[model samples]
Target: MQQQAISTEQSSPLTLSVALQVVSAIAVGAALLFVVGFAPMDVAHNAAHDARHSFAFPCH
Candidate 1:
């Protein structure tokens, strides 16, 4: 009877790397969505105004 050894060299690292990347992407995306989505209209406009002023966009 011959016993065969399983090699996980190709599968394990690749799977872990992909899983980490996916989790990280989801986390960052969710944070951005929360920041953008939960803002009131006036607050959002004011933040944009401040940003524009910082960049010297001349909104006035």
Candidate 2:
């Protein structure tokens, strides 16, 4: 009788690195757009109001 083994240790690290890179990119893009696109006080306020309602963040 013979036994076979499967290995996953080699592929997980590369997958994790790629996932982290993608998340970092999305975060950077969101930050840049929010900061640069909403520099004015009124614009920022309006955007926040809309976002709060859309996402149900509850700003009160």
lDDT of all predictions: 0.55, 0.56
lDDT of 1 by residue, 1-60 (tens): 011112233356666656666676787788875455444466765767666556555454
Q: List the residue pairs that clash in candidate 1.
A: none
Estimate, for each residue in 1-60, the C-alpha lDDT of model 2 and write its tens digit. 011111233355766656666676787788876654544566675667766556654444
lDDT for 27 in candidate 1 is 79
The best candidate by lDDT is 2
Show the lowest summed lDDT stretch of 10 residues, model 2.
Answer: 1-10
Instruction: List runs of model 2 lying over 4 Å from the truth.
Output: 1-12, 40-60
What TM-score, computed on C-alpha atoms, does each candidate reach?
0.44, 0.43
| Model 2 TM-score, 2 decimals | 0.43
